[model samples]
Target: MGHVIVGVDEGPEAPTLIAVAAEMAQRHGAPLSAVTVGRDGAEQDGAPWLPDLLLRIREKHPQLQCAGFTLTGTPADEITEAASGARLLVIGSRGLSGISGIVRGSVSQAILEGTSSPVLVVPSRTTSDKHRASG
Candidate 1:
C-alpha cells in the first residue's frame, strides 16, 4: 500500500482532523503526508498554520513519520491529487458552497462511496476547543 495522505484544512468549529490521521497512522505504522489544500490556510482560519500544525502533530505523535506541504490551488483537487496513490485519504468536511469545495467534498464522498480505504473527516468543534484550551 502507498503512504497515507491526510489533507489539512482550516476550520472554525471542531477541526481536529489531524488527530484522526495520527491515530490511524500510528496504528497502521504508515508514513504520513499532511497536505493543505490552499495557500491561505482556510483550514486554520487564514493562518499559515499547516507547517506549525504539522510540527505540533509530529511532536505529539512521534511514532508516525510525517511531512507537510501546501497546495497552491483548489482544496479538493489538491486532496484528490494527493490521495491518488495513497492508501488512505484524510480531510475535514465543512459544507463549503463553491464549485471546488462542493465538488471535492462530493469527490471525497465518491472516493469513499464504495471503496475499501477509509476517508476520515475531522470535526471542527473538537479542534477549536482544543485550540482554545491550549492557546
Candidate 2:
C-alpha cells in the first residue's frame, strides 16, 4: 500500500523493468522509488541524473509519487536496506540471478531471503538484442 522499490545498476538500463515497475506503481497508486546501486564513487556532478529520472516519472504520472536514490554500497546491501519499510520490492531476475538461482546467489534472492518485504523479480523476457533492435 505504501511504495514499490526497484533496484538497478548504473549502466545497462532495462526498459522492461522500468516500464513494468512504473505500471505496477501506477496501478497500485504507490510511489515508485528507483534505486540505482553504486560503489564508493557514485556521486557525480551533484547527482544530476537522479533529478532527471524523477522528472520523467513524475511527468508520466502526475498522480503518482516518485523519487530516485543513488546509493553508495553493494547492490544487495543498498537495496535490502532501502526495502526496510517498503510494501514491495521490484527487480530484474538477471540482475544478480541467472538460471541456477534457486541454488546459487543473487542480490534479488539474497534480499528476497533476507527481507520481510515481497520481491518481484521481473524476468528479462525481452533480451538486449531485442531492445536494441526496437530502439
Candidate 3:
C-alpha cells in the first residue's frame, strides 16, 4: 500500500495535522512519513524536532509506523516531491485568507496545483475552538 505523507512544521496546527494524518494512515494500513521543509535551503529550527514529534505520534498510536525527516528547499516543491506516489498528502492550513493569503503565498495551495496526489488540508484551530469542542 502507498504510504501517507504529511507536511509538518512548528505551527499551532501541527498536532492536529499529525493526528489526522496518523489516523488516516492507520485506516489505510499505510506507513506515515512526516516531512518538514526549510524555506531557505537549510535545516530550519524545527529540523531537530521532527524525530521527537514522530516519536510522540508512535507512542500515541503504537501500531502505526511513523518516520520523519527534514528537507531543504521551497516548502511546496519539496513537499510535493516527497508526496509523489503517496496514497495521500496531508497538510495544515495556516487559515490565511484574502489579502494576507495572497501576499503570503500558501504552500498548501501551491501543492494542490502541483501534485496529482490526494491532499487533505486541515484547518487551524484556536484555544477557543478547542474549548468549544470540549465544552
Candidate 4:
C-alpha cells in the first residue's frame, strides 16, 4: 500500500486534518506525508512549518511514520502531483464563499475533480462548530 498524503496550509484546521491523516495512516499501516504548496517567491517561506508540525505529531504518535514536503506551484497542481500514487489524500477546506455564501475555493474543488486517489476534505473546526450550533 502507499502512504496517505495530506495537503495542508497555515489555516486553523491544518493540524486537525493532519491528525486525521495520521490516524488513517496508523490504521492502514502506512506512512503519512504532509505537503504545503505556496507561490513562487513565498514557496520556501512556508516550508518550515510542516516539519515542525510533523515533529509534534511524532511526539504524540511515536510509532507513526511521517514526513513533510513543501512545493512551489499552483496549490491544486502541486497537491495532485504529490498525491498521484498515494493511497489517500486529505485536505482542510477553507470553505471560502462567493457573494451569496457560495463555496468559492477552487483549489480543493479542482483537486477533488482531478485526483485519482481518494480525497478527504475536512471542514475547519470553527465552521463545523458553527453549523452544529446553528442546527
Best by lDDT: 3
Candidate 2 has a TM-score of 0.73
Candidate 1 lDDT tens digits, 73-117: 656666777787677877765544468766645644554554455
Per-prediction TM-score = 0.65, 0.73, 0.87, 0.88
Question: Per-residue alpha-carbon lDDT of model 3 for 1-135, expressed as tens digits?
Answer: 588999988867777788899999999999999998887755466677677678888998999989887888889999999999999999887767799999999888999999989999887787447668989
Alpha carbon lDDT of residue 64, candidate 3? 96
Tens-digit lDDT string for candidate 4 (30-63): 8999998888676276566677789988998899
lDDT of 2 by residue, 64-129 (tens): 778777777777888888988887788886633356665566776777877878888886654555
Task: Locate the minimum summed-lDDT window of 10 residues in model 1.
Answer: 38-47
**Clash pairs detected, candidate 2:** none
TM-score result, candidate 4: 0.88
lDDT of the candidates, in the order given: 0.67, 0.73, 0.87, 0.86
Residue-pair clash count for candidate 1: 13
**Which residue pairs of candidate 3 clash?**
none
Which 10-residue window of candidate 2 scores lowest in summed lDDT?
A: 9-18
